[model samples]
Target: MMKKFSLLVAAFFIACSAYSQYDIVIVGGTPGGIMTAIAAAKQGKTSVLLERTSHIGGLPANGLGATDIATRGATTGLFSEFVNRVKQHYIQKYGAESKQVQDCSDGFHFEPSVGEMVLEQMLAEQKSKVTVLKMRQFDSESQNISMRNDRIEKIRILNRESNKIEEYTGKIFVDATYEGDLGAAANVPFRLGREGKDEFNEVGAGRVYKYWGGTEGEGSTFQTDNAVQSYNYRLCLTNNPAIRLEVKKPLKYNRDEYVSMIEDVWTGRHTGVQMLQVTEAMLEENRKHIAKGNVSKIPGDVWGIARITNMVKLPNDKTDANNQHMAFISTDLPEENWPWPTSSWAWRDTYAQRLKDYIQGLIWFAQNDKELPEHFRKAAKEWGFAKDEYTDNGNFPRQVYVREGRRFEGMYFFTANDATAVAPGKRPVIHTSSVTASHYALDSHAVRKREPGKVHLDGFLSYPSAVYTVPFGVMVPKVVDNLLIPVPVSGSHIGFSTLRMEPCWMALGQAAGVAASLAIDDQVKVKYINGEKLQKILLGQKATLIYYRDVNPADANFEMVQQLGLRGYLPDWEARLNDAIDQQTAMAWEKLSGKKLSYEAGKTTRSEVLKSIYTNTAPDNRNASSH
Candidate 1:
């Protein structure tokens, strides 16, 4: 009886060890998840970030190092800090004036290895509060999530390292995964594929066939269908002989899959295409100055790897090669990834390998296929894998870029309507509870395979958008309690196009992390956190809620200006932060303060006008103060 009692005591301790508890549990170590953990740590909360894969930084860590920011300063917060650290690494390693610095393009462009290193370095800073567990995937074999009503009690993870099932319980849960697997497992409501254009009034919604490089919305069709944008691996390639491992032909290479490229080459489809230069700095001075002429041929268009894909320069003589946006049959493989959101790990791996083989086979075909022109073949031969990147994974990117997945049907429906301005050169509709901002174009890749007479692949479109705010409600689901999903957020397909960018993901992740901490501290559900308080905490972290050409996170009046923007006040209309307030400002102040308070010329600036508004409008502005 004594021996049996001792064994029972030992088992209880072991079970406790297996069931780890933290303040927050975040799934997916993508930039969003990483930042979520970091932000939670900042708020004096402990979090456990579980990554299914070996590395954390997601697409940027893989090979999508070239950021997709049209307006760079629109996103700051932890993301800005991340890029600044990356830039500092280059400056420290190779002097600031070195050619490597120029290629990095202000730290936005970097090698895959450097990206992973910086992400790991960031995790190290918050190690005490943020625990990262890689190779721990959500167990989908059974009902893995323990939920009481709408709240997820705990999540079951299959530790690939230990090959054992484990449980993680937390005060708050965050679904940072691109696929939103955790939320799906918890039975949170989500939308899998495209919504009809009329469903959200999104121009490029549903089964749309849109053409590019011509008119913006010429010759298009919109219909309702369940289609997802293609997924591809962003190859980190290099022609530099010191680090070049020529792409080897996959074992199961098939010629028929790549035979279609011969037709593109035979015609002038591959020629005269706008040469997306290696880097913005590399754009010829003539092109930059817009030298117009009756020019028949463009420079760097005819041959080489550029014919196959678009290569953006990164530090240390490496290139982040992505799908050529114009090509229908480039890296993007559409129509097959619909099952990725709720598929088994075995299915995802099989799909992952399929893309790996397809890309490798594509490269192999370009190099060795006799059906191609000789000059083009030789040019393709010049490029190879960057040997320094993904060294453990055969000089290939470890992760396939999953651009879109299960979007949570949360409190807010952020759509294409929010991204584009009602009128040009003005801000979009402002959200008073805005937590972060992004300015990436509404760029969606092909959602269908090749179709005859379809000039552009079905569902491939890119349109520039105004800087926009993503509200705190975007990350909060309506039906679930104590859960926050930053990626695969509650937004439409067209809206996800711009929000899908990693910088935006990181910013959202940071907000989710901080929001999780706030929920735990206040003993409330994530949906019920004080809106003004959350925005204040984010501002304290140097996050930008609105884009101002003149004002920045560094400015003393940054938070006040952002606060004013939140109240639907456009002081100077052109984002002139220093400009004195006009009738618009006076009107906004009167609405907020309930008193007609007008400031004299030079006596009070726009910042002062906004400060007054923020103080009067906010229930408790103590936490919202910037100074």
Candidate 2:
């Protein structure tokens, strides 16, 4: 009888060992998931991060070393720290005065391998508190979620190699995947396509078709559709023969895809004139380079009929190439990515491979096609994949760039109106519980083709926008009590165009981690956490919750600047107004402190006015110290 009892006890313990609990379980190891794990671990939470592939850092570490940032000053918190670390890495490797160090002085760009190294180092710093499980994907098949009273109790994950299953229970969960797979598996309500203008009163929320170098177009500004933006892999290429892998024709290459492109070039539809028209100086510069016997290296004229010439310079003669719009060809394949977000993992892998094949074929066609211009062909041949990058993936990017994906329908729906500052009185609805600021333009790639050779560039709105705050509600789902969605966030298709930038996603992930830590510590639902206290903690973490153009520690009113900035009263305080104590400064002070001040001569200096503002408005109970 005692032997039988021992056998039963052993079985029970083995089952329990298979299921473990953590303070936070984050799925997906994109920048957002990495930041989430780092933040939660810093807060002393037992955090676990699950990545679907062997690699992490997503596009930034894949091939997109040229950071797409709108306003550089808006970067703060963990994202800013990551950039600074990359900057330091470059400075340490190359001398500070070197061109490579100067290029990364703005703390934005770096090599793919350098980015991967820095991200891995960050994980290493928190290895004691954070656990990273690679090649573990959330199982959507068995619907393996244990829920009780609408809260997710545990999630079952599948090991891709071994096909073994393990359960993880977390006090709070974060859906940081690019496809929103966890939120979808949890049965959260979500909208897949663009919403019409009337649905959210968004002026830039619909389908659009425009001809290249022409005004011919059709479609309402608010027309709704199920179409999504195109996705592509950001290729890291090199011109140096020492580490360059020449473009090879894929086994599945088809010449039919190049027929239209060749015809367009012959018909003058794909000439380089459209790019030259950007400025007369650029046209002159191109002519000068061509006159100097650099026929194959003329600026903006290297791609012939293909529009794959958007190459941003990286260190050591490398580049990060992306798509550009030409009359006939573009790097984006909108039609091929329709089912990627909803497909199974196996199907998604097949789709990714097909995209890789198509992009490779396009490159080979541009380089070796006989009908193309000889100069352009020679220039294309000069560039190839860098052998030093993505060594495990055969010198190719490990992941395809998913520009936009499943947006969570959360408590606060950030719409185009919110992003465009088009609320009542043409002012943005300010969120007092702001956590991070996003300043990128509402930029979306092509979504559909209106006709042959003409594509509808829907969801593209380039407007001067202020650095806007992302509210905490954007990450908290309306239905899920314990889940936080940092990427694939709660926003409309148009709003997500700006919020989907890499740095913004990292900021949101950091905020989600902090919120998750607070909720776990207080033993409360994420929605019930104190917003003010959460904001305080975020500020302590060096998060930029507000925008100011000229308010740093150097100012005498630095405390007042930060205090008012935290409440979202200062609009462009970062703008260096004239050195004089102007009336505009007084007006801003009045708006923030609710007390008007006279800007009379000799009445008060700028420093005195700021001191008074700080004395009157500073919170007495809260500690005023920087992190």
Candidate 3:
């Protein structure tokens, strides 16, 4: 009996020591997470992607088919590849000259299922090096993270379905969730909601509206530290009756909640029409079809035209519906999403159900309500949840659109100044060796007040800005050594509003994966990895580290010029002809391009300097690979 007891003890110890290990462990299978795992796998690193839900491609796969990108040139690396594949998917299904192919030329919009299929195919291509575990939730409270000094050695996960705890060990960990769950679990310093204007001297910081449906006279622009933007589910709707699932009245449907919105539209306080011209064209098409006595065949484009937030048209008569800026009819649920960042899974699910109920109730009210305009009612009735999309979740989106979440307080905090290029003469803080380039306006959904119809547009800034580089420091936490946060990055709320797009997140994820692989190779902290070496790797992988519309990659010294541009050595002096290149700038340019330039006032023309720089840095063997 004693010998048997000793053997049992030894077996238990052996089992405990055999926790599953990988080169990298990614928590939260958002687009960023999926891209991170894929990027790491491409580098021959064994990786594990643990997703909380059955789906993998978060918002893009769920319902956000309309890619909200500022410019196509701004995208690079895996994101560019993904968009290209999406375009090819349409081109192959439809002829190259079809409208589907033409529309997807600049913007790649597809059905939610297609997004999932593409992501699955991409992962399958790297299945040997990547392990994806769906329905695995990260237990922040009970799970243990084995920490050796500042680095995390292992992470504990609680399976949501099995109710079993499992441990995963990895050399580097990435928190790619929109919520920054892994970073929160690791006890890294992070910020929830907006910051005070004084904190980062941000022009767009603070709460703007104090009352809903009230004029600016009744609102204030005071900074509130706890005001977070709204959250919603990007509904995938289709007009085809064959695959359209009628919007059923949710169990907790409440008519009183939608009374204010209906009244706003009825009183003309809020226009029932959409803000974009696409909706108008669709409406005209519907009118023409009706005049021809073919109302039934009036096309699905006429449906969901009233909601301008994101009424993006997709292939196969499907649409991706998102929140509009309407007074109360928008999908954004104010004051309800505040607890989502730190809430327990049970609480989150409850909140998610409430949002679904609210949205469903709104749809039902718009379609069936006698008080609404007849045309609006008809349009609403034409659309329903796409039966083929998100079939596992009752044809609803599997993931709610989390616009913003816990932003890490990392090595560098990007601010609104960095977003809008207000300082340094229309130049945002440039991290020349950036992994991603973002050029979106600082856009935030309405943050309504306690009043049902009241909302503040404090976070909306629509001014166009120059493309800004997302620095590697934003991914590396200041205190945490091994973790990388690509989605809920280290940026101010206004800054995040610009970087929060799915494409940029995927780009950052790719960068994080490369940085992690390099860190593991060198056995150094993420911050300690050589920036130039990492940049070289990213550039080699076709990642865009600098933004120069005039400079083409096919140029002789394009690589060197880009490298110099990233380091802030190459300034657009022609655009700022009145301002001369400083001595420091000239020295750095010479050092990088190996060309000396005259710093004397009015001595060098911009074109001459550029030509000289390119000639000096051009490769000795022109036939050699640029990479």
Candidate 4:
């Protein structure tokens, strides 16, 4: 009897040793999570970020290098601060040839490895204010989050390393994971699907087809049919000559498995056609600018693309087309992601393996296959995968493509009406809420081909809404008081794409942190937090609270100068704004701050302004004091 009692006690101790907690716990150390931790620390809150992998960057560290930065409007406060830090890394490494300063105007391209370093540095700066626990997950034995009356009272977490269980009590919790695992563990009210047009009175909201570029057959149809947004991993290819890494076949390789999709390639209906067109467009644009005597990189042998490039160009130039395209038409990993984004380790792991295989196979195709042009084939070969980034996995990064998942059905759902066009009586909102304003067309891809030679495409509508407001209610959970999701996964599918830029994500993360801080300080529910009060806090922090339409002070182009009162990319509206805003124009406007400029007034050339900002002589306006 004594021996049996001793065995029971031992088992109980082992079981209890599986969970632990902190004041504010964040899951998934992606950029959003990093920003959240930094925001919490800046607000003087106790926070801990738990990462399932050793690396911090979700996809940027692995292969996603593009950062979707919509609107060239100057964003101050936390978002600006983050960009400044990223700028600093380029200065330290490349000095005179740094790409950071030149990359951002109407937003610029970025390399993935460089991005990983930038994020890690940002987190390290806030070391004292935040605690980061890498390589941790909530297993069955460790999955325990207790909430009391809409507040998280106690969170017991299992320390996998030391085999110990601990409890943490907090006033607020944030789910920053690309996959809303924490929200699932807490049983938050969430959703995943396209709301039929009948549900929201939206025309392009349901299944339809309207092609762009061409159809799947003609490379012209941008269609849709009850499809969630597409998802894809970003590949950071290089032709740097010095970096020559051989492409390896995925362990799960079976060439026969890709026959149908591969057949698309032979039949000239390959997805690579659109990719080539997009790439060629960029290369041609670069050439056109160079011909005009604007300083630009020559259309190089190698081209880089990312996850967000398909629909929106991230501030960094990534794409989300990995899973959006079906079979060989996209990244071909939707089936793999079916079980993913869940809290179940088994499901997550299986999906993880599939992503690895998919990405690897894609790379192999880009290198050895006849699908890609010869120039691209040679250029893509010179680039080597970064070693320092994505330390969590030997092959890929930590972030999986989370197109649409666990959208918390909050107090207010931002519908197409609110997003398509400004609704009547909707005032220029001033809220503690921080979300991105999207000017791009409401875009979605077709899931299935509608005809034998046609594809299902719809929602490529250009009717854009006014600068939509992302309310705090969108981030706040309806049932879970302490939790908030700011990655724009908080809103509907149409809304998420608009809000899914890196800068916007940064803005929302900071806003969420501020809201969390308030919930902790005032001891109030996130739902009940005063919007007016939140607006004050945001303005005080230099966040854009109201999207005022006053002629911004930054539109001083040479053509615009001649047409003072006129509103367009240029004063004359003669120049059709193309690919990217010009560097020379950007430089001049930065110094002018929207004031009318006479070409003769001041000899501050683009070179001079570049020198000033790059040399640190320009006044740094991203600091807290400026806010």
Estimate the TM-score for candidate 2: 0.87
Instruction: Compose the digit string of candidate 1's lDDT tens values, residues 144-174.
Output: 8888878888888989999998889988988
* lDDT agreement of model 4 with the native: 0.53
**Residue-wise C-alpha lDDT for candidate 2, range 542-607, written one tens digit per residue:** 777665667643445544555565554454445343344667667766876788765663455665
Give lDDT: candidate 1, residue 294. Answer: 20
Error of 4 at 352 (Å): 1.7
TM-score of each predicted structure versus truth: 0.91, 0.87, 0.84, 0.69
The lDDT values for all models are 0.80, 0.74, 0.73, 0.53
Best by lDDT: 1
Candidate 3 weakest lDDT stretch, 10 residues: 618-627
TM for candidate 4 is 0.69
Q: How close to the true structure is residue 619 of candidate 2, measured as C-alpha lDDT?
A: 55
Q: Could you give the candidate ranking by TM-score, starting with the highest? A: 1, 2, 3, 4
Q: In terms of TM-score, which candidate is strongest?
A: 1
| Model 2 backbone overlap count | 5
lDDT of 4 by residue, 175-287 (tens): 77766767767777666656666666654555544334332234332232335544456544333344433558888875554435433322233232244344445656655
In Å, residue 202's CA in model 1 sits off its true spot by: 1.1
